[model samples]
Target: MNEQVIVTGASGFVGRCIVKALLVRGVGVRLLVRDPARAAALFPARGVELVEIEDLFTASVETLQTALAGGGMLVHAAWYAEPGQYLDSTRNLVCLTGSLHLAEAFVAAGGRRFVGVGSCAEYDPTPGHLGIHTPLRPQTLYGACKASTYQVLEQLLPGAGVEFAWCRPFYLYGEGEDPRRLVAYLHARLAAGLPVDLGSGEQVRDYLDVERAGEMIAEVALGGRCGAFNICSGRGQSVRQIAERVADGYGRRDLLRFGARPDNPQDPPCIIGVLEET
Candidate 1:
């Protein structure tokens, strides 16, 4: 029997892409989802199996072990990411605790590799490229929780003989994204011929297509490397540039209204990631 890769949050935007990439590579996948019907509807891949769990944050160690049986790699992407509420949500603490418990369960279940999805928020909001070795001074509650999880797992997983990798993804734009996100918002407004309320639009961010980001994450899970890896394009582009590009696709650059909205006071001017060579 081939080793099965177990993926949490398999119904999410990025998780769906990861499952597709795994299937394209001829790897079997076991998806741990809260809703079996939803997962089935979202992903109908032949090599995918769905394991239903009521709540990952509260699932028992025994249950997790059983669900993860026969799986060699665990790609943990589940979290409380409810758009506007996630940044400061107290639910981050629950996710932090639960993720740690899941990691322990994976190790106990004889899992070989654990790949966790992190975020650019885990880094300090300095106006430059962030490397894996960049100082981690996360400001938001969400970032703090993710950084704390990575720190603990960095110390714990190696001693347990499990290979671990934390992938910090920068901005992503592509299909199935939340409508409130920047790319989706721009697309919607432009497509509808509504004026796009924008800020200075000069903030530099590293954006990668969601599918490519998912592929990079899957590579991290399947490869032998460990530690933190930035899943990004390693290049910076301004928000205005992205907006203009999207507008070009719709032939509606006139709909974009720069400085129509105020920028977040705490938002950094630039937050690009430095890509590591594979």
Candidate 2:
């Protein structure tokens, strides 16, 4: 692993895992975070240098260049939480809706490898998708943002020469995730010996453990190329099935409660996406 690296969203679920993985590989990290106190709390190692200040939304290219100078790779994992920031559709309609400006700044500063985190939602829901070979069917605002960002990167290629690889994680779960997240929420509920609430639980989706995602991202950051791939188990599991598995693992079968949670408006008619071939 290269020592000079910058990781945005160091406080996020996937970002934290990536940071930890980089540290494990003996890489020197420059973690970019918006909140200083949050950075201090998350960075357990004495080796990391936290850059807590303005972000892609606020930082100038010159300021970002100073911070990003000489980094071998830039792992772009930060974004605004949708629905609260702008209407989902509006966010996607614009180019560079996310930290794409940050990507430009990274390129300006001579960074090489650019590994980005995206969503499986980038694909349309109508088709029975399987792997990376399908046409994009982005059905939501966030998905459209990600899809457009990839297009932007592609358009900048040839001259840019920035080695870019994007990973569309189908579903991810781990400790320290937001309480509102389904998996972590279930983890907490199961830990507390309470029934987990999942509406219908009929939706079939893929879930990737954050640890595996971290490793894959690290692999791409080092020397990966410009392409998109789905980083998933390639195995579809129903919501109820996962709950049952988690309960079985935790020996809390008696506390499995079934119910409904508010579904996203753009919730695909079904949950499925083409991912990287395993």
Q: Give the winner by TM-score.
A: 1
The sequence of per-residue lDDT tens digits that candidate 2 reaches over residues 1-278 is: 34667888788778888888888888878888788678878877866888865655567777777878888688887765433443274644443544667778888888877888877777766665546656666766677788778767766743598887887777788766676677777778989888776676777787789888877787667654668767777777888888888888899877766654655555544565554543
Displacement of residue 228 (Cα, Å) in model 1 is 0.8
TM-score of 1: 0.97
Q: For residues 1-278, write the lDDT of model 1, one tens digit per residue.
A: 55689999888878888888888778899999999999999888788888999999889999999998877899999988888999999999999999999999988888889999999999987847899989899989999999999999998899999999999989998999999999999999998989999999999999999999899988888888999999899999999999999999999999999998999888998999998777
Give candidate 1 misplaced runs (Cα > 4 Å).
none
List TM-scores for all candidates, in order.
0.97, 0.86
Which residue pairs in model 1 clash with each other? none
- lDDT of predicted model 2: 0.73
Q: Give the alpha-carbon lDDT of every model.
A: 0.91, 0.73
Score candidate 2 by TM-score against the native.
Answer: 0.86
Number of backbone clashes in candidate 2: 8
Q: In model 2, where do residues sit more than 4 Å from their true spots?
A: 82-95, 259-266, 269-278
